[model samples]
Target: MSVAAADPDFATRLNAFDLAALVYEDGIAIDRLMVDFARGLAEAGRRVGGIAQLPPGPATEPGQVDLIDLMTGDIRPLKQRLGPGAASCTLDGSALAAASTGIRRAVAAQVDLVVISKFSKQEIAGGGFRAEFAAAVEAGLPVLTSVKRSQIGGWLAFTGGLGTLLDGRMDILVDWWAETERRRAKTRHRHVS
Candidate 1:
């Protein structure tokens, strides 16, 4: 619940890295990571729930990728945990076609918290915190994001990087929010922190 500032120099650090272009590299894993993140939040407490969007064009990763192993390996098991305070949403069509509408749906559902995980290259390219993501962020959505730190520029990059690239910390976020008394129960309106 603290309004403490995150590492202010994070964006400056991420922009300087010499990472390769992530577009074609491990692209499938990107989507998988996002989906799994949403799932993780859903698993964290008694009232956590999710609204998943399947991106157009076979959102499923390649069969050989062993997604089940990915879900259970290293990362904690999402299905095993359940909290009454989290929810995830998945879009059925192209983001351009459905994301805005989906936002409306969330508005109608009275879900005040939303997290957009940048767990994949595709989503990374989708302008993570721009006119689109920014709309949600501006709306005060609880974005669980993953993005290339370089693009967001300035302090936002580093501070926002967790929402973009480092989603593994979601468990900690869930636990922290719970302890802060922000989430009264799963499915209950969260007190924005």
Candidate 2:
């Protein structure tokens, strides 16, 4: 609001241009939002330190990581709040490889609950419904999209809450990926030694 209006330049960016009008004129759906979220994450690579809030699961020890990466917010605290089927892993099999690989794998594996708090509503706005919806329908899983639109700016005029309502059920493969990644890392370390 008022802050943007105070800045004539911002006013032009919003009203003088058609960006704001287009988003409001046309209501937003779910699919498009997912696509946009993915794109942003790619662009934001290595920046979002990832929320280390670790959703509950079998207790596992932490690992040695690059001091720089940890300091740079490249590694956020693990996410908390585990569901009946939730699990967490360091995404490292051994002491070497980074954690992101395992995280991605887990997401693709179809676990009941994948807790990736890195995404927002706008990112997926451009993504179509059928593609994302199909996954949920097929797996019978639910998607709990989390976002913080309160302080966001620019052409992304989002409408709705931080989360989305996806019909049908689905699964998150987080546990599988975590297990695989940990195993791989350990195997690699043993081979090296």
Which has the greatest TM-score? 1
RMSD of 2: 19.1
Residue 73, model 2, lDDT: 35
Displacement of the residue 170 alpha carbon in candidate 2, Å? 20
C-alpha lDDT of residue 63 in model 1:
27
Each prediction's whole-model lDDT (CA): 0.35, 0.30
lDDT of 1 by residue, 25-94 (tens): 3344444544555555546642221123333245433321211211222221113222455364332233
- The residue-level lDDT of candidate 1 at 146 comes to 40
Candidate 2 clash figure, as a count: 43
TM-score of 2: 0.23
Model 2, 73-168: lDDT tens digits are 354333233444647754233311233433333335543332233233323453312133223223322232333333233212332221222221
Best by lDDT: 1
